[model samples]
Target: MVDTVNDDTELFTIGELARRTGLSVRTIRFWSDSGLVAPADRSTGGYRLYDTGAVARLELVRTLRELGLDLAMVRRVLARQATVRDVAAAHLRALDAEIRMLQVRRAVLRWVVRSGSTTEELRLMNKLARMSAEERQRVIDAFVSEVFEGVDPHAPGAHLAEAMSALPTELPADPGPEQVEAWVELAELVGDEGFRQRTREMAVAGARGGEQQPQGPDPERIAEHAGGAVRDGVAPESAAGGEILGRLIGPELSAEERVELADRLATFTDRRVERYWHLLGVLHGRPPMPPRVPAFEWLIAALRAHARDASAS
Candidate 1:
């Protein structure tokens, strides 16, 4: 019950306010001392007293604190220095960033468990996973810049440099295990000196090919016929393999041309390079494409085999 301070005023002791607001007396006392809910008056025995308005103020303070507002922010809100909506909006953005960070850490842990990563590998994975989107893009950009340095952009396959450097502007706020794994592998792949040299070779060859029209054989035909031959398990030296090669590049080419085609194909093909694209696809949420390098390898072998037979004759 509230005690009457005068005919026109009524105030409650700290215990009475706690009972009314369902808050602890200690909490109320703390806020009162902090000047957030100032006492309206004092009692004869030197006890703190709060008018009815203090009870309402305590409820607002409780709500703000429960919503994760710090004491300074709570004070600001009570002081009308900021509106509740403005404070909430700012808090929401902070919460989003925190949530995204937690998601990335969770994904990294999940990948670590699946891969049984060593201490160094785990450390690397965590570092890469926690990088900001801009930092991640820089990783890819550096790789592309070094590999394609001085290579003509208009070259036949030089466009690949653009695609190679393409990483999503930001990883999904909640990336899955596959994406995390892909990112880690991609980071490692780009950092390899051997891979960089191989990619540069492809870029230089592409620029040379661009100097002439009709860049090598038709990739589609090779993928279809040569890919089919591989699927059918046809040996490259077999007569049956020659038939597929004919369908792939036509029977009009001479032994010299066949060897040239094989050399050209070999220059552009590497399983690790293909794996780079596969990882990119995983990160971009693209459907997994079947490996096409084996098929191309078969075509290269067939070209070499047939050319050799003709030279022997």
Candidate 2:
């Protein structure tokens, strides 16, 4: 097309317009034909010429298309329903959530490999990974029964069951790695011989005619002294053994009572039983106890040995 000013004509052709906009004539012609870009004027020879505004509109359309906007989305952007910034922000959030899920799956698979588990173990992993809240509660319920069996349901054993059975009864949709790890550890612990035997001993003890075991007796004193001696690395046959036993059983306790205390502590101060409570506390998120029963068992052994020696003398 020709623009005339002061009787001077300046002519621009279709190819000239394409060169000015840094676009191809074929592409410009296609856009123009599609009604997306239009010609400003038609020359005497019938060539199409576009004004500068057409170039700017074409640039916007190309930018939107390059940004993953389909023709429909590009139309929406052109019509101003949503901004590219808003759409990009929403997509960023969706991508971040996807990345987090993939990370969790990666950790889970890594655990499986590290565990070197059997096919059955692998199946269990998948089942536990997908367990619903109700299903998780059922696991806790079964553990509770196994641990609390033969104990007075109304006794302290029942309280222990309620306290230690602290699984959420349902895992959340997106449990953190710690929660998942906790469940795995708890499952293994409940099936352990140490934990089961500990609970069973406590239950048997409870059924033996008392709500709570008596405290402050000579047996308690002996257990404390004997227990401390073992924990502090004092040998049962050491000279200090007599001192610890004397402090525990006292000067008033007869030789007969001292021997009786030895037998009683041997029966009750079981290390495995103590460990059961420790594992239960971990499951229930309770405060921990310092392990003392191994030391006590050592003391009981020492006391009984002394009793035997005294009888021989």
Candidate 3:
């Protein structure tokens, strides 16, 4: 039923209300018909007449509509079915999600432009950007599971399995193009059978519990010695290289331990595995660590040379 107006309240026709509120007559009539802004009374001529309070209501409706509220939600607000505060909160959440999606899309498109991506690549990146957090996590989880399945979790270097598998529960809400690219490349790397086998070799060697297990090396000494050797072009087989190795690992070591250490390092040293951690660090905003594989490779070669020389003597 239409609301009645008291004699104390002044009424305005639809045309008059439109002029006062700076809204069009057709819009006021449409809103009136939609029950969002109803007439307070009707004249004998049956023209819609609204009281002073209708002006305020019409302004509220116009403001709400301009702010992207559909007629249905506006009607609910007018009918007291939901409060403006509650509706605003819900809309805020929706807007936040939309904003995040737009940010990701912007980043992805920028990457596409910068990279001159092919059509298939564009399609793949778009699909990745649209995936939910859980979906992204599942991709990593499945890769980790396949690589480490049936392995003894408590074995040596087994702890690395978990660390290697650790992916953020979600990408950052507004991930950069490089981060997205990291994820895509990481996904592809993890799916490669050769890469999987390499990782498995390391895991199995670690699980063997002998001298074949992976070990941590001091980064500072390696940078000083092995890294310096590479910089100075000191060949791994040279006498100078042997002296550098002695300083790094100590001159007192027996040939057998040297040989065992060399074998153990060979089993675990993989450029791709190091790359996986490096990519993850980039994603998580960590300071970039210098590549250690080359240094270690040199060390392995030097150790093998010393073992050979010892055997010859």
Measured by TM-score, the strongest candidate is 1
Across residues 1-313, which tens digit of lDDT does each residue of candidate 2 receive? 3442224434456687677777788877876785666677776667776666776777877776565666666666656787878866766775665664555455457767666678887676656655555676787678778867767777643566676566665443354444455566666667787766766666666545553443324645545776677668888767787666656544555556556766655556666556545654544556787777766666666666567545554
> Which candidate leads in lDDT?
1
Which regions of candidate 2 are displaced past 4 Å? 1-130, 146-150, 155-158, 168-182, 192-198, 211-228, 254-263, 266-273, 283-288, 309-313
What overall lDDT goes with each candidate model? 0.87, 0.63, 0.81
Summed backbone clashes in each candidate are 0, 1, 0
In candidate 3, what are the lDDT values of residues 165-210, reduced to their tens digit?
7877667778889988887788778879999889887877777675
TM-score of each candidate structure, all chains considered together: 0.75, 0.49, 0.73
Off by over 4 Å in 3: 1-6, 9-13, 29-35, 38-52, 70-82, 106-115, 122-135, 148-162, 165-180, 191-193, 200-212, 215-219, 237-240, 249-259
Candidate 1 vs. true structure, TM-score: 0.75
Candidate 2 local Cα displacement, residue 305, angstroms: 2.5
lDDT of 2 at 82: 77
TM-score of 2: 0.49
User: Which RMSD values do the candidates have, in order?
Assistant: 4.0, 11.2, 4.3
Over 20-91, each residue of candidate 1 has an lDDT whose tens digit, in order, gives: 999999999999889899998787778888998998899999988987999999999999999999998988
